[model samples]
Target chain A: MTDSINATGADGGLGGFFQNLTDSIISQIPFWQDVLLPALWDGLWVTMQLVVMTAPLGFLLGLLIAVSRVYGSAPVKWLAQLYVIFFRGCPLLVLLFILYFGLPSVGIVLGSFMSALVGFILCNSAYNSEYLRGALQSIKRGQLLAARSLGMTKMQGVMYVVVPQALRRALPGVSNEFIYLIKYSSLAYVVAVIELTGAAKIIASKYFMYFEAFAAVGIFYLVIVTIATIGIHRLEMKYAIPGVSGAVGKVSKGH
Target chain B: MFESISAVTNSAGYLLEGVGVTLLLVGLSLLIGFVCGIILTLGQVYGPRFARWFVGIYVWFFRGLPNIVLLFLFYFALFPFMGLDLPAFGVAVVVLGLRSAAYQSQIFRGAIQSLSEGQMLAARSLGMTKWQAIRSIILPQSLRLSLPGWANEYPVLLTDSSVAYVIGVAELLTRTSQVISRTGEPMILYLTCAIVFILLNYGGMMIIQYVEKKVRIPGFGNNEAECL
Candidate 1:
């Protein structure tokens, strides 16, 4: 494809090289407009839907698990702790395969989308809970004790005094996990859900233009991640209560 | 599930071989990532303004894209077009390593930054060149501080190595699926696969923790030590 352009650039200087590269890229604009843009637009909608549906559910599940781990009675605490370990230990793609592929054998089949949704929520919440747990632990014991001494029930004290501050402190780590969710949500494709990466794969193989297709897809992912990160930063700043320090040194990363 | 026990047993050798390949992928990539990470960290930390900007963009580009897409880009397109014919496994290793380097640099940067400025100055005052100062003073402490975060890259990379399965690399997950199709017992087989991964996960962490204690300077690391 660019071999001809490369041959011409070989005889020319850097300016000519850049010119040829731009010329080739500019020539492809019509094809990208007519072909890649429309398919990618639809796939993006599916991806956005996945993020919108999963984020809150995962965060809510995360809060429950974190709370239970920090405050629940014996068995409940152990179970919640175990849940975090189990899901966090499992690779999300394999978990998706098990849910989407293996579940039929147990006579509980979920659609591809549902399977991905369940898998992501499980994995996402586990990591989120880890962050939440740290935040919960970082809350001063005096706050909870004070709330209880004020005639507040254990649940009421935790709900009112401890959790709000902890969530604020954990906001950075939680939002970091949120960004990981968006990137890895591309894994949904392995189970046959045609989201963003899946759409790119389909188009690449169809057109036999692997480079163009994947490069364009990379741009799509990069743009969305950039936007999401900026948005999260804004939200984090807005919620930054003056005294609650978002702790440093938390290892919030993704595979 | 019971009958398929033999199938797994028979391919226990195959599966072990798969585990070896998986380890090789993670091992080699992490090694490469570690090397690249150090360079990128130095670039960001001590290099000029342009270098910092370049490192910033590199990290953003690699970290922001999904692993699978990076695999697709390099494997299907970039490598072949450039006329180098690395196997899917090699390409996977390289992509994973380079992507990992971005994450690793940040880990190293954080570690390097955590050291007091006085240490660098002390090394400089002792007639040490910048490289000598870094090698003798900066790296010793920062690498230790960087361990927990750096060790974390193991599990992350281990899980991500599964993405190489998409390229048909005959890794553990690929072998597991092959055995799954043969045995027709997805639950047992997949569960087995999950257990193996979890074992691999903590097992690696155990070694890392051992090294952490082994190399730990007395009265060093963690917040309490930082105040001193």
Candidate 2:
């Protein structure tokens, strides 16, 4: 896209070469205004808000559902199962549409951003509950017996004994779901919530620079996921139970 | 309400066509993803370090990026940059397939890892090569074991294929949007679309469950708790 004398371009040496390259790329495209700097910055902020707002809330909702499904009475368990089935089976985009478009027909209205958040919260909670349910199942039955023997109430035992351990065991799976939440948050853009992917689309269509725009967006996600992966690994180590798979080899004592 | 019902019925042909496209996307992508997944699993588990690193990056990118972003990237940028100019349907298949491969590879890798190492060792001591052991001994069992996890991928890809509509792939969601624009009854149309997806998902899961039950090993992987 650029036509110039390459030999004459970087007269200032190695530093000049990079500088010229940056200048050429900038000149060739309105990189800052359209693609790279401000666009991604604003998009990143929105994306952060989406993840930050959704992750904890979703996890708590999921934890509640998981607990209910595992520990609730017959009617409660059936209700939980139905909720999981509906949310889990419906595609996120379709759910967003139903929330944003379908709900308004019934006198319930949500703005575009709120609609996305609600949909994501529902979807996330379903999957998160599945993960937590697995963790709950893995715990031994004796745990509840011990808590009861210790005179703790049913809620107290679940809260003080069972949940802490289940949470630790569930950390890896929960983090995996959190990573999924990060990616699916991009779907918010579908309902006109200008998150990262939405911003890239706007810029890409505006400038016809799909490669640069999406590539930058891709890099942004890659960095976030990579960091999350490492963080999850560290958390696993920190919280690893002695006999669990992720724990280091047990120490030995010599006579 | 009557007009809305008639509108949906009138557009039923178009919606069915969209369903066909959606199924084609899911089917072809699953096939491609399965093959690539096998190759990736072997590479990550049995191949050299460099091969593992390459597959690692492949999985990382595809898994990390949202489906819509990847759809746009392939449909708009990468294919055009390479001068491929492939059809939207084909592009959707490849992108979705590759993304599925990333997840599928992990599923396979887990299955392969669960196979007892002594099986391969015994095969090799019986004069079979590594590849032969993998082909004859390991893969047969692991592939069966992988079926349960792989079955879960169906619903995942089914949901993900909805993103292909963003690139004008004319899938179910896209058709519903078109129908909505025409009928001005988004509630009914979108709910219909949702019900269709739920039906498709549950139907696929039922088939997978049948296969899983028929082929399941008696002592291992039968416990629903561990399978999860």
Candidate 3:
């Protein structure tokens, strides 16, 4: 009934035909106008915060763990290994549930956002550590020896000579991990953080505009990922070492 | 501790059923991914410019977006728009599989790239067509090379399957959440789910690692293999 009426309203004009089509499509997904889009923007903001906070902290933790694993005493190595295994083996959702829901049972209560952050940091750090460890190991022993010959102690050798090169080599992998964080940060919604995906789910259900709502969310992620991909490419070129095979090679080595 | 054990026992059947769903989801998706991934890899490596561009855009969208968002998009939007009334389980499998295809394609592309171009040239010189060269010469070695990296995907897919719970796929995480709600034992239930997932993660990885070991050419790419 409404379809024919709208078609007739087009008045045999091309402009009206396109306008009619747009209006009909928009009418069916009316929630797009006042509700879901705004919710998604808010969710995008939360997602951004999660990624920003988690990236630096996670990278720092990963670097510490990796260094300890590579150069620490036996106990330190054992502890770092355990941390990596535990965090890496656990599914992120389960880890988040443990942090947000389970911990309160044992008198450690974290709010949803904090729980999501902690879970992300732990998981992110463990994976990042793996990459860093691989990079650390790939550095030639001659570099360390050269540092030692220069009157530097083992710690200083690592800190000055080894770590700089390792970090430089590790940039590609680290940035790849950061891109993953941008996507995985959507899981924050599971713990009630109301990030982008969560916002889409709520609006989709509330307004039954599943197609438009989720499509908009997908666009948001696509935009972030495009930016990340370009940024990572630039970083790879900037940090590229002659004869090192560059970003894709180094990053893929992490996996 | 005894009470916690009892709670686990009480829900053991449901949890096992959940594991079945998880495996079903993972297995089907991995199958779909393997098929689609190969096509995508081939497209990127040897196809014409248009095909390569198509593959690039497909991989970019699938890889760039979050799995959860992709899952939601498929489960809620795409299928419904297409007038398909598939169950949540079906939607989960398709979404995970397609998303995985993107990553798997990259893995396969790397493996294919590691191969020397001489193989294809040799195949062509031997009077083989381009398609024949790919099928006979290029694929076997690259497929073998892809195994080690491909094995890594198992754990990744397993971890990602937990997100299916958002759409009520009744997987392991969903089952554990249900048990927690009923028994008010979030810690034990959640821990049990974690242990199960970890077991799957490590166990699956170990099996794939074994396959990799069997298929590996000893001196072909040992340095790279060890680094990975």
Best by TM-score: 1
Candidate 3 lDDT over residue span A1-255, tens digit each:
888766655453455545644774767665666787789999999999999999999999999999999999999999999898888888899999999999999999999999999999999999888878887888899999998998999999999878877887778778888888999999998898999989998888887878777888999889998998898888788877786534322433111
Mind giving the per-residue lDDT tens digits that candidate 2 earns over B83-128?
5779999999999899888888998998899988999999999999
Residue A135, candidate 3: Cα error in Å is 0.6
**Per-prediction TM-score:** 0.94, 0.90, 0.92
lDDT of each: 0.87, 0.83, 0.84
Chain B TM-score for each model? 0.95, 0.95, 0.95
lDDT of 1 by residue, B1-228 (tens): 558787678879988999999999999999999999999999999999999999999999999999999999999977765556899999999999999999999999999999999999999999999999999899989988988788889889998999888898888999999988876888777878888988898788788777777888778876321100
Which ten residues in a row are the worst by lDDT in model 3 chain B?
B219-228
Query: Model 1 chain A: which ten-residue window has the lowest total lDDT?
Result: A12-21
List the per-model TM-score of the A chain. 0.91, 0.84, 0.86
lDDT of 3 by residue, B150-223 (tens): 77778888889999988899999998899888888899899889988988877877777766777777776543
Model 2 — TM-score against the truth? Answer: 0.90
Q: Write the per-residue lDDT of candidate 1 for residues A1-255, one digit (tens) a residue.
A: 598667656655455546755675688898689888788898899999998899999999999998998888999999998887678777888898899888998999999999999999999899888888888988999999999899999989999999999999888888888899989999998999999989888988997868778888999999999999999999988878888867632755676
Compose the digit string of candidate 2's lDDT tens values, residues A10-76. 3444544456546646775667554466888899899999899999999999999999999999999
True contacts kept of each: 0.58, 0.62, 0.73
| Winner by DockQ between candidate 2 and candidate 1 | 1
lDDT of 3 at B213: 75
Q: Candidates 1 and 3: which is better by lDDT?
A: 1
